[model samples]
Target: MTGGGWRRTLPLMPASIPSASRENKKKIPYAWELVGWLWLAYFMNQADRQLYSVVQKQVQEALGLTDIQTGLVNTVLIAAMAVMMPIAGFLGDRLSRRRIILWSLLAWSVATMLTGFTGGLVSLIVIRSLATAVGEAFFVPAATALIGQYHVKTRGQALAFYQTAQYFGAVSCGAAGGWIAGQYGWKHSFWLFGGVGVVLVALMWRRLKDAPKTAAAIACSEPIGDVLRALFRTPTALVLTLALGCSTFVNMGCLAWAPTYLQLEPFNLTPARAGFFSMFYYQLFSFAGVLLGGRVSDKIVGRRPAFRVELSGVSLLLCVPTLYLMGATSTLWVVYAMLGAFGFFRGLYDSNIYASLFDVTAPRYHSSATGLMVGFSFAVGSLAPLALGAIKQSYALHTGISLLGVVYIIGSLALFIAARGFFPSDFLRNQQTVPTSPKL
Candidate 1:
């Protein structure tokens, strides 16, 4: 694809790729604009997910649901998202991503709005778990692949900035959703956030433009089996996927339970205050970590392709102690400090998840590859809520949460091994297999 129109210029290509790429210097600004749009989209995506947890307590009491039932609901939603990832990823590769993203936003937003109207657990499962999951599942693969396609030169930083939306959405919505639930009702909170998502959809429809379909992209678009085989054959990809699974397990459990944990026992904060404290300090420092990690990775990856993996390893290791401390400490200030440190390192690890995946996988398989990675991670993570809920019945929340440190330690080791052994070969292999030109 030419570097004109909505398509941005390709950066350094593999030595084996053809050198006849079209040179257009124009679309650079548009790339950043695309990032901006994605930032909003991702914000909505995360905020919508957090809505359930933010008001889960109220919903549980209103519906006379058990903790296990609440966990089941979270599991169903995450499982549905996992199940849809491959299909969504496949479509993202062949279809218009812009259109896919637009429709996804519309579908999930509508579901979120409709969630307010639910009268029972069955309806909540139908709307929030099944429908919402199906809609939201289509977003990440297409959106992240689009960013990877355009912002190749500034990919790390761009993606990092895009990820900050997660922190923003989670932290802000955690507080806002709790306040809304308390002031109005949990139902109105859903309505408010869902309405905001719908507005963003209109904005995206007007501003977001698709890149021109190019011959190289068409030629490179391989069958689903081929894409899967190519990605899975690489040891680095396998290791990375497993590591992500471990990370997701910790993340999903912590995010789903943190506020609830804070509301109980030693820190008995109210819903709004609990939500605020749960996400505020942790995500606040995390935002800085992501930006810093991205900038550092981009600047250093040339000389050290293993930089991303190493960073992830170190971050995960750091997170292990912080996570454990957050649970073990009875002192609220100590818990807060540990959580802040945990968030910072977690962000550092998260900033390169997709970037590291792209480093090994071919450009042609970006969407599908992302789908598989995300699908696997979420599928494993889906079990966390249920497991944690069950554990909470028999043990303290702190005990269950501290177990997450083990998962982080395992993931850290796996990544360290990948960096030392598999990364260089996988990185080289992907570069050689794909076209040099950036496809719009």
Candidate 2:
């Protein structure tokens, strides 16, 4: 079917129809240039967010806020991101992806810089949560979609490279934020990271360029209603969205509170040590996992179309025991090993999360689909910080963290069901094109 015909029958068509119908463009080396800078952008993306968690103790003390309030700060940031996901996705489909990303980086950088000057809760909420999150929300859908456009054959590896920046950013910021806060002050940590981000904005503006348009890009400009209608109708997409929500629930809760947990009771580590331990062990192994999973998936995807979702499910199931033991055990060595194991599985899961979504989604609707999924996931998952915070207040931090295992279990089950049942049909559907009637 022609692109125009597919538009009319979009509800029945699979996501890859647009791209598959288009003539293959010559593979461009510019793909490398694109992912390179995007890696940096994502690094800053996560680092800026993770800083709040590392410095939450000091922020609470200085601001005279409670645990719930600290959680509220993260809640607000995530909520802002969630609210903007659809808007971001729509714009990404229509606008210059490079320009969207540059502006996003600039907006978030400015917000991060202003975060240094906050006087109280109101200022923090305005600068750190609202403004910064709005900027950050514009990034992922556009950037990921753009990368997909460039590296059709190398999608997994390119995305895996992008995923590594997340691990490094979280680890570095979590550790560095603690030390910076201890010595120079928490405000200075914001100033330092924010300043670097601003400098990168100038660099990205000069370096980054969007991919040349193709049938997929042209087709992607469909109205928002059409995009959403098609996306919502796909069972695989819906399942993945719920699965992502479950992943985020565990991730957001742990990222916000793990350092604080380590600083208390049995271990009693200093802020810097707690920060390092909380992220370093897990992310380090996660770093390796992305590399391993990406290569493995790329090699096997042709033979096993459902491998991405299957891998995600298996990884999450593996995380269940590790997450439970990480909190239940008092042995630091046991905790550390479990954290690494958890990170490995998570890395394996993370490597393919979006790639799996892309498999079932049309290239034209990539950004919008990403936005809907991310927005929904983040909105639902935003409750994690507050929910876990409240749980911690009522019970032990270990118990709060242990409860995350249950979320992982549910997510794992969803993915497994999708992998076994939904993926084959959906993937095969993308390969089938329905013919449109001749013009009257």
Candidate 3:
């Protein structure tokens, strides 16, 4: 879906959208000079997002918090992100996504550094919950939207590579955070992470350009409220949002509990070891899943276009069975394989969450819509951890896994329905292509 050849998004910009100026088109697809910095930024984004989770054991013991309490704390963070998204989404539309992303990265890093200074529960909650989510709220929506802007022909593939950095960053950080906790202490990790973000922000500010807006968008600018209303009204957007919410629900639940689960009876691993390994396995598989899913989605979408979404539904179907197996298993290797399989299935849906959205939304609203999804889905999904944690605290890990498996089934159904009914068709929308490709 690059800048040239013959690209049509919808009723908005029907004339064929060409590749970028010959110079851009001529650049190698993975031209390090062009996309390297953005990739680095993506890696950092995941590092920060998952770093705290990686160190959950140390934090829990040191602070003397409950599973539900920690879950509640994370909930606060997600909620903040959710609440900020609509406003940020709106800003991303009217303002600059690149600037918003840079600022967001900077803000969260500062909050991360502040996290190291806290001595008690309240302070940790404030730093990790409010400040962290608030800062992150702006980063993903804007950054992803920005990525989608540049890569069109290979939108699925490009976004996949870009998003792969997130998995790598997180997997690296989760392992690093464990080692840091084991050696220098988690406090130092926070300080170092914060500094790295500050540096990245400075670099991005100089490089990123605003998404190229179409002449039609500028000429036929819709009222902001009207845009918002229309966006919410889009059947595909609504369905995609709910479908994503379900995926996030499973992800959050599994992430929050998997470490603790590993630390339990059969595994009996040390806190640091369990934490590292738990994250290590899932993310390892998730990386492969994401990359493959992106490639698969590209091929499928190229053929059916509706398969852009239907494939995800299929993945969701696969996910439920494996997730059930993941939860019910007691054997370490079995669990690992199941977790990997789950991640693989999940990758298909994760990659398509926004591809489906990009199919329906206007170019100007792309960032805004992305923000809304980032904020709301993340926020809503935050509850999964809290719920699972409470269930673990009350009953057994088995119970929670079983419950989560049920949730996956429900979410899978939603995706199936969306694929069948809500997938936006080029036939129904206009001839113009969505100006922005999808951000993963």
Candidate whose lDDT is highest: 1
How would you encode candidate 3's per-residue C-alpha lDDT over 12-92 as one tens digit per residue?
221223334533765553323335667787788778777777777777888898887777877777777789877777776
Specify the highest-TM-score model's number. Answer: 1
Give per-model TM-scores: 0.93, 0.91, 0.89
Error of 3 at 416 (Å): 2.0
Task: Evaluate candidate 2 by giving its C-alpha RMSD to the native, one decimal.
Answer: 5.7
Model 2 C-alpha lDDT per residue in residues 1-440, reported as the tens digit of each score: 11232121222222332342243453534567688899999999999989999988888999998889889999999998999987898889998998999999989988998998887898899899999999999999999998887766578889998999999999999888889998999999999999999999998887798776655555365677888888887889999999898888899998899899888889898989988899999999999999899889888776677788899999899999898998999988888898899999999999997888888877788889888889988998789999988988888888988889999999999998988778776766654532222222
Ranking by lDDT: 1, 2, 3
Number of backbone collisions per candidate = 0, 1, 21
Record all residue pairs in model 1 with backbone atoms less than 3 Å apart, i.e. clashing.
none
Candidate 1 lDDT score relative to the true structure: 0.86
What value of lDDT does candidate 2 attain over all alpha carbons?
0.85
Identify the runs in model 3 with alpha carbons over 4 angstroms from their true place. 1-35, 216-221, 424-427, 430-440
lDDT of each: 0.86, 0.85, 0.71
The Cα error of candidate 1 at residue 255, in Å, is 0.5
Clash count for candidate 1 is 0
